[model samples]
Target: MENKQRLIGIVLAILGASFWGLGGTVSDYLFRHQNVDINWYVTARLLVSGLILLFIFKLLNPKLTIFSIFHNIQSTIQLFIFSIFGMLLVQYSYMASINYGNAAVATLLQYIAPVYIIIWFVLRKKANFKLFDLIAMLLTISGTFLLLTNGSTHNLVVPSSSVIWGIISGLSLAFYTIYASRLLVKFPAILVVGWAMIISGLLMNFKAPIWQFSITQLNFANVSYLTFGIIFGTAMAFFFFIKSLNYLSAKETTLFGTIEPVMAIVASAFWLKVSFLPYQSLGILLIIILILTLSLKKEQER
Candidate 1:
């Protein structure tokens, strides 16, 4: 029974990661080919996905009230902060990075969130500074330099805006990862995340209303990609990832989550015909190695 459960967890984790990675590629396609508006797309995606997640949670836990998070003043404040700074910022920055760069570069850059988390811990003195931590930092810096420069000091393979947005994506993700944990302990993941997304979506809609899209932007291909991103990529991906925690250890699930960036890189190259120079490829490999090293270190500590 345990073995079977583990197998199920592994499959769910892979599916979740695949959706996320491929979703980024889909967004890239829409941005580059369809010329979709990023603000409207992100707003609609968050709103729809959040509604779907909440609907599912309500079905599964009919007795639990979704509005309970707002019952407390402190939780309400934290939720608002997380909605804007953590969830909204991460989504907008990631999509902006993809718009300015290819999905592969954007995804890999976001993978540096773990490095940011480590730095945050060290700065706060919450974690002991170790030799491996320094090595990880160096590896991250070297890999980022190569990725941006592609082995040349004079030329940049990706735009400066892409790099900036990608770094913000990583920082926001680190913030989300740390802050979400506290909310998750008191409320269920679905409740907290769903509420966060809806709040963020509503906030974003103030800047670019989701209902104001032109009819020309509602073509079959654009609609299909947006649907896929909202349903499979956002809602189902979050669902599967959270479900996998029941059967697998957090470390094992995290290790499997690495498949996301790999899938993004592969899908971008094959589907989008995005290419990377040899030095950039090497840089990607180093970042992958860094992720594995950190995951292993965590496993060892456990």
Candidate 2:
């Protein structure tokens, strides 16, 4: 039974990675061809996904009302912060990066989340130092540098604003990862994610008003992609992630989740016909190894 559960968890993690990878790729296409503003796209995905999960909450746990969940002032404030910094900031910054840069470049930077997570863990005194952890951190930083430069030290060209936003987005992800994992210990993962999304969606609507666009300007060709992104990419992927967490240890699950960047690279290459330099490919490979090394526990060495 243990082995079976582990296998199931692995499968779910892979599936979640695939969906997220595809979503990243589709996001680029949506922005380029669909005439959708990054803010609007972010808002729509959050609202749609959040509303669906809210419905699920109502259907399955009608006894435990969302209103009741917010009765505690601390929880409410945490939820607000989670929604604002964790979801809104991360997603908006990511989408903005794609708009300012391209999907490949933006995604490569976003993968820096792992490195940030490592830093967060150490700073919070949640984890002690380990030789491999430091090595993994080095690899993560180096890989990000190579990926940023497209494997050429001379070609390291990024706008100042883009660099700031990318790093901010990367750092924000650490908060989201740690907070969500901790909150999962006390609250239903789905409920936390749903509320986070709803709050993020509402906040984004105000920050980047959808009133800027008209229905007539909407790009119909991109609707299908957006629909799939919200339903399968966002909602279903989150569900599978939570499900996998139930079976696997947090570190194990996170290590598997690194598959997202690899999947993104492959998807961008095939679907977008984007090509990377040899060094860039090597950097991406390095990132994969680094994440794998992080996931392997010390006891596994025995």
Using lDDT as the measure, which candidate wins?
1
Clashing pairs counted in every model: 0, 0
Model 1 C-alpha lDDT per residue in residues 211-286, reported as the tens digit of each score: 9889976789988998888789888999999889989988888888898899999999999999889989989999
Candidate 2 to truth, TM: 0.88
TM-score of 1: 0.97
Q: On residues 195-231, what C-alpha lDDT tens digit does candidate 2 reach at each position?
A: 8998889888886664656777646566688777778
Candidate 2: which pairs clash? none
Stretches of model 2 off by over 4 angstroms after superposition? 1-8, 123-127, 157-162, 209-213, 218-220, 247-252, 298-302
Q: After best superposition, candidate 2 residue 92: deviation in angstroms?
A: 0.9
> The CA-based lDDT of model 1 is what?
0.90
**TM-scores of all predicted structures:** 0.97, 0.88
